[model samples]
Target: MRIERLRATPVAVPYVHDEIWAFGRRRGQVSVLLEVETDEGVTGLGEAAAYPSADIVLAVLRSVEPLVLGEDPFAIERLMRRIELIGTWHHVKATSPAIAAVEMACWDIVGKVCGQPLVNLLGGRFRERVECFFYVARSDPAEVAREARRASESGFSTCYLKVGSDEPNTDIERVEALRDGAGPSARLRIDANEAWAPGTAVRMIRELARFDLELVEQPVSGRNLDELGYVRSRVEVPLLANEASWTRHEQLAVLKAGAADVLSVDNQMDGGLLNLKRSAGMCEAAGLPVVKHSLGELGVALAAAVHAIAATPNFTYANQAYGALLSDDITEGFGGGVAGYTDGHVDVPAEPGLGVTLDPDRVARYAELYRTEGAAFSFGDPDPVLRSPALPKF
Candidate 1:
């Protein structure tokens, strides 16, 4: 079916609590939702995180309209190549979410036209249900303990917490609290988000490893593979690469440098679901496992990733999702929050395409939310005292 037009909607949905990371905090998620309308009355849905910003994603959509309209939605490979090389968007990695959204929309359309779910199209289900970690947004020790306790009591096997705060001791205390609350059986994973130098990363990760951390994510900067290798060699905890492996190209570099034990992949960061699958395959060939990374996604994007993850074999760890943080979702009965999950697992949608449908009323509500209080929901940290927060905080 020929593509007709693309609809891009920037929506902001509140998080149950503010997501605090090393450099910034966000009170909610901002995702630019895409709907690709086809001449055959088939519409495909896609979602992209407002990566650098929502405005960038919207501008990308407008700029790419000429390349997408009148093209065959079924020819995703050809269409994506045109957008990347011909449109000269291949090297601009920040523009990936927008391009990925288009590619996602095409896959959705292909699934609908062929009367198959995305999981089947990508590969028949390697898994029927995908496991996700409980996202414990950074807070005081007591609150961290409480969140961890809830995750453990709810039967979630993995609990992910943000570390690499300005105070190293404070991060240690929170990990201690997580252990106390979640008990020893729960898998505790921490992400520093590339906030430390190699020497400091080794010291802090060694101290934190006493708490039984399952994996340490992006402790040192991603730009320098030598530093990453230094940290990996020094720490007992296996390092999972995030910023180091945003694209397949970077992933190949990471592999060549022997910088990481586990790799984190994201369709939004690269280009599309096909790339996600390709990333996992590349990692598998290198004798490494991959995990899905999220830039704080809502339902549409979450469902799209689940389909791809379910079809792929190497996603051994609990993938990242914003379900614990999002207060609500725009979808019909899937991927909302804790209510949408069972024991921290989300079943793959069996319906055609994404197997999830948008709730129009909820979409309108969140769109209005974006219009009114969108400034508070951006990736930018609003703490005025922390102007231009720098990483490698020693």
Candidate 2:
């Protein structure tokens, strides 16, 4: 069936706690919900993490809709290629993310049409549940200890700490406090978000090795593969690559160079499920582990990630897949389908397709709020016209 219309809605979601990371700090999630309608009366949903504002997301969606308006939704590859060609002129992430929103929605339609979940449409499940780790929000040592204590008491098997944000000494103190609070049972993972120089990363990794971290992600800038490789060779802590490995080629390059032991593959940044499988295949070929990355994604992407990690044979480690821990979701019921985790391991969903459903009432509620917030711009303006409210509904 041909795509009938595309609509982008902006929504504001509050965070459970103050979110402070190497990227920045925030109190709420600013996101854009992408809705696509087709001639067959089928509709699908997806979301893009547009921190700072949803205007950028709306603009990107409006600009790209015309490129695929009358095209067949089933020809996803062709649609993606055409969108990419149009996207080359603008900011790559800004353009690519909106396209991803549409791509995911189309896949949702495909799954619905075939009477299956998105994962089943792509491939079959490899596991039942994927283990998760919470990204601790504390910056100070005492607060880190408190948060880690709460997480341990909450039944989480692992926790992720934001390192490289403060002085090395300060980071060391925070890790020490967390380790003490979490005890030896809970795994500890650290992410620097490429906050440090190569020298500092090496130094911090060597020093933090005493705390027994599971891995350290993007300790140095992703631009210099050589430096990343050098740090990997020099440090004992396994390097986990996020921004450094975005595609299958980059993942292969990182593996070939021995730059990382683990990969942080987020579906939004790594294209979609098929590309995620390809990247995981590269990791499997090189005998590396694949871990899911968090992008303030709602339940849709979370379920998609769970299915992907379950479908990949090489993904043997736990990751920050605990979206349930960070988000105050506006859709669905309490606790999306988690297969269960034991000793830092999780299984995949046994249900058909992505094994999840969107709560329409919640979608409508959030959609209404989105329109109210985005109505500041006139429909006649070029910006608002691109994101037409007059788009067809399923």
Candidate 3:
């Protein structure tokens, strides 16, 4: 069936709790959901990560309407190539997420048309269920520790902690508390989100090593491969490159530099599931394990991630889908509304086309919020400081 229409709906969904990162705090998440309808009455769904700005993603999706409308949904690669060429020719920076949304929808269409699950279409199932981690937002040490304990008690073996505060000691204390509360057996991974300078990252990672971290993510800025490599060399823990690498070339560069022991792959950032699979293949070839990364994804995106994880073989690290963090989602009929994880793992849906149906009423509500309330916070707004700078000691 040929593609008939594409609808990009902007949605503002509230977070279960404030998501505090090094850059900012978000009480709500804004995402653009792309619904592609085929001539044969088949409809596919996808979500674009519109975190700092949903408007730009919506604009990009609208701008590509001429290129996608009436095209064959099965021609995903060709459509992506055309979109990429147009984006490059026009110098559009925020086209990846938009294109990713479209690509995911196309895959969904393919799965439906072929009467197979997305994982089967992508290759086949690698495992029955995909393991995921509980994401703990930055907060007070005691609160963070409490969250970690809850995740552990709820059957999660892994917990991801957001760190990289201006105060190094505070970050250390948070990790220590998390370790204590998690009881030493639970795996803890820290994401710095590129908050530290090279020297600061080295020193901080060294000090934090006493807590026995599973890995440290993006300790230094993504652009500073040399600095990331230096910090990796200095620390005994595995350094995972999140913001540092998105595309295959960047992944190769980081691998060549010996900068990261693990590669964190996000479908939204890498463009789509296909691109993420390609990057994972490269990582597998290089003897590196790939971990899935999430950017405040909802049910649709989380379902897409589960399918991707099911098809990927070298994905040993606990994946981050973040669907549990959202107060509500736009899809339903799964463990936790099509995106929910049960016992720290999500079962790969056996049905066709992402294996989830959209909740039209909830989508309408979020869409109204997007149209009226807009985003809770934008990236350009003054950075939210979790902690002030420390006084210099004599």
Off by over 4 Å in 1: 384-387
Among these predictions, the greatest lDDT belongs to: 1
lDDT pick, better of 1 and 3: 1
Reference-based lDDT, residue 183, model 1:
94
Best by TM-score, which number?
1
Candidate 2: tens digits of C-alpha lDDT, residues 1-394: 9999997766655556666665446554556777789999988777776633567667778877788799898898888877767655223542345666788788777877888756566666666667777657778898888878877776777888887654567888999999998889778989888888788788889999999998898888777789799899899889899878866667777887788889877667655666777777778777788887766666666666776776677766666654423445545542332223444444444444345566767667656655665343211234334544221100
Go through the candidates in order and give the C-alpha RMSD of each one to the true structure: 1.1, 8.2, 3.0
Q: State model 3's lDDT.
A: 0.81
TM-score of each: 0.98, 0.85, 0.93
C-alpha local distance difference test of each model = 0.90, 0.70, 0.81
Off by over 4 Å in 3: 89-95, 335-339, 377-394
Error of 2 at 62 (Å): 1.5
| Residue 78 C-alpha lDDT in model 1 | 94
Clashing pairs for model 3 are none
What order do you get sorting by TM-score, best first? 1, 3, 2
Candidate 2 Cα errors over 4 Å, as ranges: 51-53, 86-95, 322-327, 334-355, 360-394
Q: Which window of 10 residues has the lowest lDDT sum in candidate 3?
A: 385-394
